[model samples]
Target: MTAKLADKYGPWGVVAGGSDGVGAAFAHRIAAAGINVVLVARRVPVLEACADEIRAEHGVDVRTVALDLSASDAVARLVDATADVEVGLFVYNAGADDISVPFLDKDVDTHLSLVRRNCGAVLEAAYRFGGPMVERERGGVVLVTSGAAWAGGASLAAYGATKAFDLVLAESLWAEWRGHNVDVLSLVLGMTDTPSLRRTLAAKGDAAPDGIATPDDVAETALRHLGDGPTWIHGAGDPTGPSPLGALPRRDAVLAMSRSWAEE
Candidate 1:
């Protein structure tokens, strides 16, 4: 499987937000599969630590880029950083809102920054990294989204919107690139036990609920089903099935989501 992955989407892989949690999991798995990895994240210390671990454990080259994806030139900088290598896999996994307050409670700039990071940067990464993959006729792209994207919720306004955008973008790209041998997957996650989620829950003086997915499990599942594109819902009974809220009326779905947030 490792050899197959390397031969098909090998040489190098880029994981934005590849410091800890799901991003780091992806980096480790990719490296273990014999692919050199370029790990991009905001914290220099955490990024370096993760890179070093991958290098030691997997015996594969690992590069670290301490970059904030919200920056306007992030994708351009990433392209320049990896200009010498052929990145056959690109995973944008950085969008996670640490706050879960109502829309009006958060400042305008904060929401805008989230939009920049989650939506704009993701789109740009897909364009820049995915284009090269299409040109070469072999590569995979995974856009890590959230189940919040299924409907609008009380405290997930900006976050949900951005993830919805990612979901659509990945599915659309899959439609256009499947014939070109470029796989695109929108990995929709539910509650995951990541540092980001922990912080969010901590801020509310709460702990993670039972049965939340783990980063390593999520990463492994996504990588194994790279070609089962369009969409993949982690932890769902039917991974490739319709949304859990598919049969609900739109208004009821929104209300249901809002109630969940209120309970949280």
Candidate 2:
């Protein structure tokens, strides 16, 4: 049978960075599963387009807010924008990688942007939304950290470090909020077929992976595991891999697999 999630997480959901890539996928899938979705992103047209598509397809309520989460008051702004909503699922999927130049060759602005985007924004959103979810005593959170969180690499040093922070942040929040019935998960995602990935790789003179997953694949997995409690490597690899918590995932196993297929 095709996997399906119970509707416990429906009624309302928030997709941060919902205008692109896996975040859009999550927004669509959740709406398809009978959830009202609120999409947050910097681009209005893209965000509105996604919301419109989901609403047309699933006949569910869809809302959009265009804001750059890396801005100084992003969390406060997000809270203000979503003040009237009750979110049952929160997906933090927005992030950025620094220009892939040698660390010393990178400008201070690019470095600061990376930190604010990856670490500051994520942390701020989590605390603002997460606290309310806990007070309500039911909800799920998914942080889209990367498999690059596993190791320190020369080309991916800044990105990897930021992802590593995301991983630990999810775990710590999960532990702290367990008693309040809030589920927290770290999705140590492997390479997936997305526009951003394609653009990034192409810019680097690289090709896309052979067996990359669609955004729908990852979104479906996220739904099925919602409220399953704190989980690490919550979703990894393609659909061919084991389901979340079905088996203990090895960091090396995914890294080796991704590296073998990554663009040259």
Best by TM-score: 1
- Cα lDDT listed for each candidate: 0.94, 0.76
lDDT of 1 by residue, 110-168 (tens): 99999999999999999999999999899999999988999998988999999999999
Residues forming the 10-long window of minimal summed lDDT in candidate 1: 1-10
**Model 1 misplaced stretches (Cα beyond 4 Å):** none
Candidate 2: list runs displaced more than 4 Å: 1-7, 232-264
- TM-scores, all candidates, are 0.98, 0.85
Candidate 2 lDDT for residue 12 = 82
Show pairs that collide, candidate 1. none
Residue 183 displacement (Å), model 1:
0.6
